[model samples]
Target chain A: MLEIINPSMVSLIQSIIIILSGLVILIASIGILTFDKDMPNIVYVRIHVLGMIDVAGIVVFLALGQYMFAVMYLVLAPFLAHAMANAYFYGEDDYNTLYADDMVEDKYAALNAPDKLDDDAVEDESGEDADSAEGNADETASENLDSGDESND
Target chain B: MEILLISEYFLLVALVIFLISSMRVISYKSVAMGLIGTSSLTLAVTIILVVAGTVLGLGFFKDIALALLLLGVVGTIGFAMVLRRQD
Candidate 1:
């Protein structure tokens, strides 16, 4: 069904396209991991990197002669990205964090929304960075064990 | 019998990415990283599946990639919601 382009030619195209996309994905993966600690909102940066992956992947699919999936992803990718961003900033995700807890109790905090939002974003990034650090596992494991024991009781 | 008619160069690269993203998803503590990593891993798998399946003359791989694509979107939304969920 995909006879529009000669098969051998298609392979040559895919070789160039797929390799490039794969390399892009790899480079972006490195960025995501490497900058996870350094960035203030790593998720936003991740989302952008993922957008690059999406474009590269779509090109790979087009080279593979799969037009439908390429289009499907094109339509859905923005929606998915939006969902992620909205969920991060708007979703009630910060309840467990002490900062969210403090902000929740203060009624007048809404007046400072513009200023506080940036601070909260930075704080959340740092908190999550610390949470994900390799050496911090021992602390989290112990915390989890304590929580598990509490649940058992 | 040789499986795929295509070169193994991209396959090896895809496999490396598959492994790296898999590690990120499992080892990372931040839920957002887990979320992003899982989606990245899914795309990497999709690339591997589509390329290998096409070269091997298997149409099912494309179908599987379709399924993975759909799930990747659904899973991204679910992860975000889970992250946003009130504790």
Candidate 2:
């Protein structure tokens, strides 16, 4: 036989837990917001780790029905906070963008010799001219349709 | 019945506020302002839970659930501290 627990006792425990979850999420939000972009990659990883914790807190609170709705909010709060930090502070393409461009150049160099690359550029220039001709034909067709409409009117 | 309906209405409002605040927190350039917005959202959610708890009786699920929520809060604070120190 299993021992029975009092329902009131459970409520008290749940309330306490809910309050704790809220405080943690608040701290995480503050941490992520205050984190400077100049910090090392290790810092970003740590922030993400905390974000994962926040997610866990939300899921647990969601399960508790006493303040289930309340728990849901606690869970969502960190996700929102962390997500914002990611988009605003961490999203700047400054260093990464330059690095990405360098990577692209390296790849392009690897794929073709410098002379061959110049040949490809000339080919593209010709291709663009062809495309412009095609575009002109499309514009002419649209103009003809407009003229037909004017004639009907 | 009226209490339940009222709670539901308030819950909806709170949910909308939560969404708006979240968006503002993310988009705002000021880190401090974003934190304030997030705190406001936390408060709103807490109110929501209290209102919902009043409507729905406390039970076993509630206790376990609240404990988990507390853990999340703890985790958030830990991560925040880690991040703050990194900065």
Best by DockQ: 1
TM-score of 2: 0.38
- Candidate that would win on TM-score: 1
| Candidate 2 residue-wise lDDT, B1-87, digit = tens | 443344344444534544454555546564433443554444445444544554565455344445554554455455444444442
Question: lDDT per residue, candidate 1, A30-125, as tens digits?
Answer: 665676455566667777877887887788778668899899988988987877766766553453344666777675677567888887776655
For every model in order, the TM-score on chain A comes to: 0.54, 0.43
Evaluate model 2 with DockQ and give the value: 0.04
lDDT score of residue B82 within candidate 2: 47
Model 1 per-residue lDDT at A86: 62
Worst 10 residues of 1 chain A by lDDT: A89-98
Model 2's CAPRI class is incorrect
For model 2, the stretches where C-alpha displacement exceeds 4 angstroms are: A37-57, A66-92, A114-153, B1-87
Candidate 1's C-alpha lDDT? 0.70
